[model samples]
Target chain A: METEKGKTFRYLREKREVSQDAKDRLREFNRAKKEILGALKEKDMTVNELGKKLDRPGHEIMFYLMTLVKYGSVEAGDIDDMDEYFSYKLKK
Target chain B: MSDEIRAASYDALVIGGGIAGGEAALDLANNGYKVLLVEKDLSIGGKMILLSKVFPTLDCAACITTPKVSEISRHPGITVFTGAEVTSIEKKGEREFETAVTKRPRYVVEEDCTACQLCEEVCPVVVHDEYQYRLVGRKAAFIPFSIASPRVAAIDIENCTLCGACEKACPPKCIDFTQETEKYIIKTGTVIVATGFKLFDPLKIPRYGYGVYKNVLTSMEMERQLAPTRPFNTILRPGDGKMPDRIAYVLCTGSRDDTIGNPVCSQICCMYSLKQAQLLMGALPMADVTIYYINIRSFGKGFEEFYEQAKGMGISFVKGKVGKITETETGNLILRYEDINENRVMEEEHDMVVLAVGVLPNTDPLSFFRNGELKADQFSFVDQAEVLSSPARTSVKGVFVAGTASGPMDIPDSILSAGAASSEAISYLKQ
Candidate 1:
């Protein structure tokens, strides 16, 4: 339920007109975010492992992982046995 | 939110919200003068708050900044306006100036916000966090930093999708998309310009491979990594998240170079790079740290001693100019330099490279005045015509300049400069 103040504020806001390109980009980002979360739910994995699983580049996977980490949807664990990558796990 | 300041006349208006401006405002307010402080950013603590530690002292930058930020906020004589810009200044009388200021909307009411971060947590958009030097991502609805004064959340309207998730998640329902830019007229007796500098972009030097190389970073980006609120658990190269065993610092990246159109010394790069080297040695005991410089300027209080201390800790200082940096296949960087003492071209390999970029003079003061323009020196900083007698006196009679607004200086010097500016402004008001 929206508070009266919030409802009035929303009514006063100018309707945002999002472009088709921006919508498409948001959809793509949402898709990637969902895929990353689903994959991380199974088990903890390094960025390399997640990239391999998703068939994405390591840097792209790293970006989403870090974003998720910041938002508290994901957590980063200790460095892997190879001492190269930090493992990511979904925060329950 | 300083609501009473809307139609107010003040004794002083201090532009910029960095350490210098904070000090100036505090000084004027303590002297029984009403003040209005304007900061263009969402929060007031400027570049000083973004730093990790100061050179020679190694004091936590936040330790010095947070207290001042709070003091400025609590002072009854000073009213602060964050996320606000002065549009124009017209001189009406000898000491009175009519200034028009525009306050940008944060999209969240400051009084209603609890800073609980629930809105930030629910925000879907992720953008480069400017506070973290873009090394990590921050939500579109975010608090600027952990220790940000006012501790309020602001919406990055540029990146915000207007998804309304934050509105739904907010407990106090503080999210307000209806807020628009508000304008106010302020009449002040005197003005102090303390707007600080912007760092040089390393991308200008193509040979350095700053943007093209994954492991190469600017001094500020490295500073963010060393900060307590750092993105990563440890200081690791961004390329592959690998620990860099060997790190190199290239001094005078954009300053002291004729090609970059900035031919003045930045005045603090040498000591700051030395400070970072010492910090890196403490953080990574096994790592080998090296600094390449054309000349080492350690001519400040305890600065030469700090340099000697860094050297005593086994940090290598190479007297050379790094000509170019080439990246290898495995992500190691090769530095090509002319070793001055050895009289030969030399090459070295390191896992990471940090470019100690310079600072440029901000030319914002020129546009602040509409009647008679505030003048700038040849290098474009606020002109100090009476630097010998009064370093803070500008070309304008009632307008003064503080801190790096005039030229390049270290933190201690900036504080001293602010004190001088405050004293001059007080005298001008008394007249």
Candidate 2:
């Protein structure tokens, strides 16, 4: 049941000498990204809103959101009524 | 492309791929001389390409640089090496300079990459985008910029986790994790050092609250937001993505101050700040813009007129020196300064403050010479032996310095400096 992507990932893991620290950090980061995506799947939210919901800094949330937007995993919509923050949602 | 560079000897070796290096390379190549240009960065267009617009003219920066980048790339006589560093340069004989350079690995094969950006989408790591002044994030696999001359993607191997997502996603299958750094030795008749200046770190001035305050951004950061390919949909402050109602500019953040050790004026800051102010007026018409400066040094051609025009556009030019900045609870900034005109201290609150940070000598180019060190001025800029008559002549006979390598200058002056360096290099090559 090892797919092509999983096989390639395993091969790379064996080839490169990745540190345990780095692996752990990546695991944590992936978890955060999953949380953000899961939240966005439920509803469109501003960076501040996501920050409050996830208990992370607004700036940190913005960085993740923008990265997601860049990769087409997320889409930024119109600014709020107060013309302050742009709402981000899961890509259609 | 690197094959061609490795096989042939060049007539001239131009260090740095900024405006000056590109001009010098083009100038030498146009005169039927073979030239090799090396840039340490991922792309040829240096600080100029990152800018919003040029001062006094207000012409689109990309419009000017894209054609030059294209011309340089397509030029038959010039062989360019991007993502390359000149490891060492030593005189082999009386006429030739032997330079050892290493081309850093771009994990993605340059020739095969179609810039499809699929690899970028699959890469999970999110890192600060230096091109956007860290205002945004970029994937480990990235295209340097929209108008990158080669239009190739490079992997930030340092940040890449060896996840194989990019390799799997790349249609061209150009992603090769096993790729190693390439080394080459180039023999050239003459050398032109045009390695550009680095922006002074505003973080060095602790009182300015650069890193402390989310709203206090460097001038280059603001310039990124003003650029055509801005990070955000609009000009929103980084702290909370709010449209700033009032923005303040603090000029000379790290330059012309004896206390910080750099006492010389960065000639381009005043004009560039004014240019940004004008652009901001167009971008955010309802917003109020104010600039605080010790002096408005507008010495370039039509620079004085440009300053007056900015004033005419209702931009408030306050004659003051901002000493410190502090952030409010709501992410707004309060600038504490001495108002020279009023002869008293003043406090001004604004949604954002941009530190007009100065330029410093890169000095990395000077370290590359193995035989003898190129002489540098007190401030670490490459020194000119005869600045009046021969501004391009470095202490090393066959080696010349141009653009901000010699001293800080505007784009036009940098081009003229490149011309002088190329002309000097040509003369040296003939001898």
Candidate 3:
């Protein structure tokens, strides 16, 4: 019952058909996810801290954090310092 | 449900899906009232969701908003109408009001469309990403933002090529460009207008050279840069991708300007500019941040403390009024303003400048009410029945106001106003 425009939009949105490109991106995404998990496995850190630890940008770390948070891989904790940042930790 | 059933069943309707609207709807729903939440945008998180952090508290804007948005979505007592607006409202049967709601096509079917975001990748059309405050580009067919409610994609049909590329690319074949605009009628016992406010366009003041100077950006744009999901990885000058080492914030860009007809001060700009300044320090550790202001009004709870904290953190506070801004050949902005304490004119160059734009009432109640039953004040904000005490009750019976729809205030006040609106509506229904 979806419209043709919507089907095409979703198809391109998922980008599932781009075999090589999709595989490469998926691999990169998994690599970032593994780095995040490994970093958090040792200590709870803020997004900025994790970004620094993993040699990634804060924005990019945030994207991964949201996904990890969504999938129960991470849990955001209390404000770190006077509300300037929120510390995050791996879910037990 | 059929049109007849959809038209006549709600205890209350909250217009807008911002923090205020979300709070009001949740409050009303918890009180056993069926509430219809209408949002003009495709998603419900509102402008606050697009922000990096809130003032004073510095809590993640998305962290606080997304939960309420999700609750509103899952609440049994609430119904959300996205991509819709109230066309008209009229009193019927003495206490009940009948409202006409018009909705634009989603292009992609909401229920069928999953927010895979791949549709955006395949689309050839590129446009200014308004969600990022035009700081970046987005595909014409896209979800509004990362945490968009329902996580569905909506097409910008006007700019869409309609070449059927999106249709062919979709997995569920959910891309439907054939949807038409629809209108429906709903009856509610009471109403809460949380229409929110729009930021004053910095382009209005030519001196700041907002649009003319590439490095002169608005505070919202800077906030976007600090946002977790930003277009750029680091703080960079918009003119070129070079990282800016020196940044200046010009406070009161649009507020308290008699020439611009916005004499009333925008209450939150000072604190927000400071917040962004503090955030810039975190984003670019080596960058020097300076704030030039005619006055620093830190009126809210813990705001003065937050101001002191910023100063302690090494942000330079200049007591002056910026007179003019001109760009150098190297794309640095030259600020000419009188330093009050020094009693002298000073010229400073910064790699980038941020204009702390003011907020203006975004809604005209008269447009939705022909009889002028629901009213607005001289400033065009919906008039509160009791400005000194009651923050929500409007001039008309069974109608209320909340958030920036009434006047300029911060997030906490907006949420409090929303609660007050809910209390008034719940009481009205009981009576």
For model 3, residues B1-431, the per-residue Cα lDDT tens digits are 12331356699989999999999999999989999999999999778988999989999998998888999999999999999889999887545989999888787778888787778767655555788776555666788888989689887765665546666678887876556677889889998999999899988898889877867888888888898887655675655445677899999988999899898899999999999999999887878999999999999899999999999999999999999999897778899999999999999999889999999988655578877877788887888878887768888888888799999999999999999999989999999
Best by DockQ: 1
Model 1 lDDT per residue over B374-425, tens place? 8899999999989899889998888899999999999999999999999999
How many clashes would you count in candidate 1? 0
Residue-level lDDT tens digits of model 2 in A48-89: 788889998766776667767766778887778877678888
Off by over 4 Å in 2: A1-15, A19-25, B1-8
Q: Which ten residues in a row have the lowest lDDT in candidate 2 chain B?
A: B1-10
Q: Rank the candidates by TM-score, best first.
A: 1, 2, 3
Model 1 ranges with Cα > 4 A deviation = A1-4, A19-25, A49-58, A80-84, B1-6
**Greater-lDDT candidate between 2 and 3:** 2
lDDT of 2 at A39: 94
Q: What is the C-alpha RMSD of each candidate to the true structure, in Å?
A: 2.7, 3.1, 9.5
TM-score of chain A of 2: 0.77
Judge the docking of candidate 2 as incorrect, acceptable, medium or high.
acceptable
- Give the lDDT ranking, best first: 1, 2, 3
